[model samples]
Target chain A: MTTKMKIKTGNSGGYDVLVLAKHPMETGNRKDQKTGEMIPAHFIQTMVFSVNGTPVAQAHLNQGISANPLVGINISNAKPGDTVSVSWTDNKGESDSAETTIS
Target chain B: MKRRTFIKGSMASAALAVAAGAGLLKPTRVLAADWPEAALSADQVDAAMQAAFGSGDVTDSGDVQIKAPLQAENGAVVPIQVTTSVKADKIAIISEKNPIPMVTVLDAGDGAGGLYSIRIKMGETSPVHCVVSSGGKLLRATQEIKVTVGGCGG
Candidate 1:
C-alpha cells in the first residue's frame, strides 16, 4: 500500500517518526452515503516501529484511531542515516510496511 | 468418476497447503493473538485497565504529560501527544466518555523513551487519560478536551 512516513529530529535531539497510511478505519457504526448500509468494521489492529531492523515500539490499536491514521513516536539516541521502518496489520489480516533512512 | 475427482482435488489442496507451510509466500501476516482483544473491546475504563495491566489501581502522576487541545472543533480527529519522565514499559490512552474507553496501547522498548503521538476519535467532550505502567506501578495523567462536534457516528 506504499504507506507514507516521515522522520525528523525533535527538540530533544531525538528522532520523531511519523507514519500516515490511507485507510478507511471504519468503526462499523457509520452508514454508507449512497447505499445507507452500515459499513463493516475495518481498522488497523497493530503497528510496529523498528529502527535498523530492531523493533523499538509497538502499538495495539482499535477503531478509535482516526481515519487515515497518523501515528508518531520518539526514538532517543537515534543518529542520522539510520533506517526507520513502520509496519501495520489490519483486522482483516492485511499488512503493509514502509521504510526509509533517517536523513 | 466422482471418487476420482474428489481424490484429485484433495491432492491439489494438500500440495497448496504444503507450499504455504514452507513459506513460499510473503510472511507479513500478523496473527490475531498479537493484540489484546479483551482490553480493546472493554467498555469501561476500569475493565480495560484490568484486562490490559491486571489492575485498575492507577494513580495520578505529574511525570506524565498529555498534550491536547482545549476544544476540538472536529471530534473525528483530535491530536494527542504523550511523554513521560518516568521509566515506562507500556502506555495506554483512554477516553472516559467514549463507548469504547480504550483507544490504543503503546509498548515502549528501551530506546523509545515512553513517547507517543497520534490522532484519535472522540464521541464527545471527555477527559483524555494517559496511563503508564512503570516497574509494576500504574501512573496516570489526564486532560479534558471539549468537543464541538461528535466523532463516533451519525
Candidate 2:
C-alpha cells in the first residue's frame, strides 16, 4: 500500500490527519486472480498513530470491520500541523508503514 | 518419469470430473471461521463474556460507556461506540454472536486518553462486549442491542 498521508484542518471538526491506504485488504477469501482457490482471510490487525514519538490513536481490528474504513480521531491538546506517523500490520504478516506532517 | 501416458490420461479424467461437477462450485464465503463462539449458543455466549470480563463486580462507574442502537433497524451493519471515564491503556470490543467472540483489541498508546470509537458489523442479535485493560488488569462491560434484521444488528 502507498504510504503517503493527507493532513488538513477538519472541514468542520477537529481531525489531526486522515490516513488512506492503497491495498484492497482482500480478506484472502477472495478468489485469486490467476488461481481460483479461495484466498485466506487477510486483513489489518492493528494500527498505531503517533506524533513526535508519542501515541495518539491505536486500534485493534477484526474481520467484521469493513475494508478501507476511515478513522476520525479527536486529539488531546494537539493542534494543527503536527508531524504524524502511522504503522500497520496485516494478518499475512505484510507489515508496512508511512508518515505525514499535518498541514 | 516414463509414466507420462498414464499420468496424462488420469489428468484428463480429473479435468472432466471437475468440469462435470462445476455446478457444485458454491464457493465458500469466509465462513468467518474466526467469529467468537458467543454467536452460537446463549450459554456459551454468557460464559465467554464472563470469562473475558467479570460481570457482578462491574458497578456503573462512569469509567466505561457503550454506544449502539437501542433498537437497530438493520442487523448487518450496526455502528457502536465505546468511551471510558478515564483514559485507558487498551480497549477491546467484541460481538458475542459473531463467528468469533473477540472482535477488536487495541492498545491505547500513551497518547490515548481512554476514549475509543469504532463501527463493527453485527451478524445477528448479540451483546457488544467492551473491555479496557489497565495497570495489568482488565475491566469490562457489556450492553445488549436488539437488531431489527437486515444483516448484523438483527
Candidate 3:
C-alpha cells in the first residue's frame, strides 16, 4: 500500500510534488477473469499532503481515479531539506505514507 | 454522589464513541466523514454538480484552463493538468460520460494555490469539466476528450 512520491523544483520558483500510489481502484463493477465474481470497490478514498508537519493539501478520490493514481501540486516557498509527506487511506481501511526531503 | 458520577462517566464515553464512529476523531487524516459520497456517486453530470457545488450557478470562465490531449489514446489513464488565474481554494474534475460524473476533488490549501495535476479514468469520449471554487464563486472550464478505448471495466 506504499506510495511512490517525488519532489522536484519547478521553474517558477516552487517545488512540484508528485505522488503515485499503487492500487487496483476497482469500481465494484469489474468481474474476475476466472471466477466471474464482481470485484468489490477498493480505491484510495483520501490523500493528505503535508509540509514540515503542517497540512497543506488534501484530495478526495474515488474509483474513477486511474489505477496507480498519480497526483501533483506545486508548493511554494519550500526550501532545501524540507520534508514533504503524503499519506493515503483506501476503502478497505488500509493506509500508507511516504516522505521525501526537498533537494 | 456515586450514582451521579457513574451517570456522567457513561455520557462522556458515549459522546466520544459517537464522535469516533463518525470518523471525526482523526484530525490529521481526511476520513470518510469528509468524503462527498453523494456527489461522487451521482450518475449524471448535472446531478453531480448539484451535489458537489450546491444550487449555485457555475459560470464558464476563461481564466481556468484544462490541459489534456484532445484525443486520449488510453482511457484507462488520461493525464490532466489544471491551472487557474483565480485563487483556487478547491478544484474538481468531472467526466460527463462516465457512470459517475464526479471524479475527484482537490482541496488546494494556501501552499498549493492554483496548480493541480492528476490522472483519471474515462469510460468514453466526453467533455471533461474543471470547476474551481475561488472565494464564493464557482468558475468552470470544459474540454472534450475523445477516447479510443473505454476505461471503466466491462
Candidate 4:
C-alpha cells in the first residue's frame, strides 16, 4: 500500500473507484541503470478530501501531467464506514497520505 | 561659458547613461515554454480539481466524455469515466501530467449525468484531459492512454 485510495457512495453512474495506485510517475528523465543523473519531479501539487475536514474537492496540477497521479472524487453524503480520507502535497515539499473504510 | 560648456553637458550625460543601460535588459524569457508540442507522458488519471477552469467562455457539444483504457496495462490505474448531459453543476477531470495537473473536481449536487469515477496515475504515455463545466460554459474531451506499469518509472 504505497499509495492508492478509492471510495464510493451514491453515484457510480460514471463509475466510482474500486482500486487504484500503481505508481512510477518518474519525471526526472530516466537514468539510473546503475548511475546516470536527471530525476527530479516528485509529482502532486495539492489534493484535499474530508469527512471530518470538510472540503470535498480541489485541483491545480501541472508538469504535462502523468505519473502516479490519481484523483477521483465524487461523493454525495458518503456512506459505508464514513472515514474515507486522503491528503497530498508535492513540488518538493513532499507529503503523502491515504485511507479507506468501506463495506 | 567654461570649457565649451562643460563638454556639451558631459556629452549629454554620457548618452543618457548608455540609454539607461540598454533599457534595463532582460525581457526575453517566457518560462520553460514547451507545454504540449507533443510527447505528453504523465498520468495518474481522474483529475478535474478546480479553483479556476477555462478562465472564460468555451463551448462545443456531445456533452463531454472520457471513458479510459484505450491502452493502459497499468500506468498506475488508468480507469476513468466522466459523463455529462449538459447540466449546470460541475464535472471535471484532468491528467495532462498529474503534478497536480488539475485532476478530479466533481459536484453534481442532485447527482445526475455529470457522472464521475476515478483511478489515475500514469507517468509515461499520456493524454487524458476531460474538462466539463456547466451553465457558465466550458467543455472539452481528450483520450489517449498507454501506461505499462508504474506511471513513468517503468
Candidate 5:
C-alpha cells in the first residue's frame, strides 16, 4: 500500500510528479492456467494530486492501466520547495497516499 | 524563465502577503461529478463508450497524437503519452485487449494544456485509443502495440 513518488521542478517553471504504485492491476479477463477461472478486476479507480493541500489534478483509472502503474502530471504553479502529494483508491476499496517535496 | 520572473514579481504584492499571513494559499478542490464508473467497468467497448460519453460518436482526428512504443517487451509496463492540439477539457484512454476497455479518464482543468503520460497493462497485442473531448466533441487517435506476452497473468 506504500506508493513511491518523485517530484521535480520542470524547465517550464512547473513540477513533474511521477507516481509508482504497487498493484496487480488485474483486468479480470485473464484466466488461471491451472484452474481456468477468470481473475476478478482489481485496479486503481481514482488518483488525486494535490499541492499544498489543494487538489491540482485528478484521474479516474480502470483495469486498462498497466501493473505497477507509473503516472505523471505537470503542475503549472508549483514552486521548488512546495509539497506535492498523491493518493489513489482502487476498486477493492483500498487506498494510500504518498507525498514528496518538489525539487 | 522570463514568465516565471514576471509571475513572481506580480505575485509579490501586499494582497498576496496578507493572504499568505492568513494561511489562505491553498485553493479549494474542484472535484468533477462526471466520473463514469459504469464505463470503466463495462466489459464491451461500445457499452463503455455509452457510459463515458453517452454515445460512440468519436471522430478520427489528426490533431490528437498517441506516443507509445511500436512493440512493448513487457505488457505490464507499457508507457504511453498523449497530446492534443485542441483545447481539451477531458482525455480518456482505452485498451482494446483489456476486459474493461476504458482505462483512464483525466479531467483537464480550466485552461489546461492537454498532455498525459501513463503506463498501462495490456493483456495482449492490442490497439490503444486516446480520446480528447473539447467543447463536447470527441476526437480520437489510436496506436497498435505488439505485446510479446500477456501482461495481466503471464
Candidate 6:
C-alpha cells in the first residue's frame, strides 16, 4: 500500500510528523450486504517511525484504527534537513514505507 | 572455499556490520517498550486496562484532553486527537464497545512531548477513553461519541 507523510519543524526545535496511510483496516466483523458473509480482519498491525534511517518510535495498531489511518507525533532533537520515515506492516504480512524531509 | 560462496558470505556479513553500525537493530527496542499483547487482546475494558498498566486505577484529570466529535456520521472512521501536559510516559486509546477495547498504545521517551492524533473505529455509541500514564500515576479522559452508522461490519 502507498503512504503519505509530512514533517514540519516547530518553533521549539522539535519536529512534528504526520502520516496518512491507505488501507482497508477491515475489522472482519462486518457482513456482506448480499451474501451476509463475514469479511476477514485486515489492518495494519505495526508501524515504525525513523529519522535518517534511525528508528525513533513505533506503534501497534488493531482493527480499531480507521481506514486511511492518520498518525501524528512530535520528535525532539530534530533538524530541518533530517529525513523522517514511516513504515507499516499489516496483519496480512503486507508492508510499505514512505519518507519526507523535515522542513 | 568456492569463490562464489566466499563472495556471498562476505557480502552478507558486510551488510550486517553496516546495520549494526547504524544502530538500527537495538535502539528502537530500548526506546520503545515491548508491545502490550495481552492488553490489546483483552476482551473486556477493565481486563485490558489491567493488562496495560498493571492496575486500572485511572482517574479523571484536567491536564488530559481528548478531542472528538459529539456525533460521528460514520463509525468506520472517527477522528480523535489527544494532547496531555502531564509529561506522560505512555498514552493508550480504548474503545468501550469494540470487541477488543484497546485500540493503540504510544510510548513517549524522555523529553518527547505527548501529542497523538488518529482515526479509530467504533462499533456503536460508547465512551472513548484516553489514558495517560506518568510518574506511576494513571490519568484519564473520556468523550462520548454517537455513531450513526455502525462500523463493526454488522
Strongest candidate by TM-score: 1
Residue A88 Cα positional deviation in candidate 2, in Å, after optimal superposition: 2.4
Question: Between candidates 3 and 4, which one is better according to lDDT?
Answer: 3
Clashing pairs in 3: none
Highest-scoring model, DockQ? 1
| lDDT (10s digit) by residue, model 3, range B5-62 | 9999999999999999886564422346577777777888888778877754899999
Could you arrange the candidates by lDDT from highest to lowest? 1, 3, 6, 5, 2, 4
C-alpha positional error of residue A57 in candidate 2 after TM-score superposition, expressed in Å: 4.6
Chain A TM-scores, per candidate, are 0.92, 0.73, 0.93, 0.31, 0.92, 0.93
Global lDDT of each candidate:
0.88, 0.59, 0.86, 0.55, 0.79, 0.82
Over A1-103, each residue of candidate 5 has an lDDT whose tens digit, in order, gives 6799987664444666788999887776679889987666677878888888887777888777878889876676677778888898876667889998866
Q: Please, what is the TM-score per model?
A: 0.86, 0.62, 0.85, 0.28, 0.75, 0.80
Off by more than 4 A, model 1: B1-31
Give candidate 3's whole-model lDDT. Answer: 0.86
Model 6 residue runs over 4 Å out of place are: A10-13, A33-36, B1-34, B111-113
Weakest lDDT window of 10 consecutive positions for candidate 1 chain B: B23-32
User: Can you rank all candidates by DockQ, best first?
Assistant: 1, 3, 2, 6, 5, 4
Give per-residue CA lDDT, model 3, range A15-46, as digits (tens).
Answer: 98999988888887899999998777788988
Candidate 4, residues B1-154, lDDT tens digits: the string is 7999899999999888887787533232112222221122223232123244435344555768777888888765677877666663655556665554554444444333355656666666767767677777778787877666655453
Worst 10 residues of 4 chain B by lDDT: B29-38
Name the TM-score of candidate 4. 0.28
- Per-residue CA lDDT of model 2 for A14-86, tens digit only, reads 4535555544444333476676776656566667788875876666565566455444344554555677787
Q: Is the docking of candidate 6 incorrect, acceptable, medium or high quality?
A: acceptable
The interface RMSD values of the models, given in order, are: 3.2, 6.5, 3.8, 10.1, 6.0, 5.6
Q: Over the stretch B82-140, how does candidate 1's per-residue lDDT look in tens digits?
A: 99888788999999998889999998897785578989999999999999999999999
Range of the 10 consecutive residues with the lowest summed lDDT in candidate 2 chain B: B33-42
Clashing pairs in 6: A30-B153
Error of 2 at B68 (Å): 2.3
In order of TM-score, best first, we have 1, 3, 6, 5, 2, 4
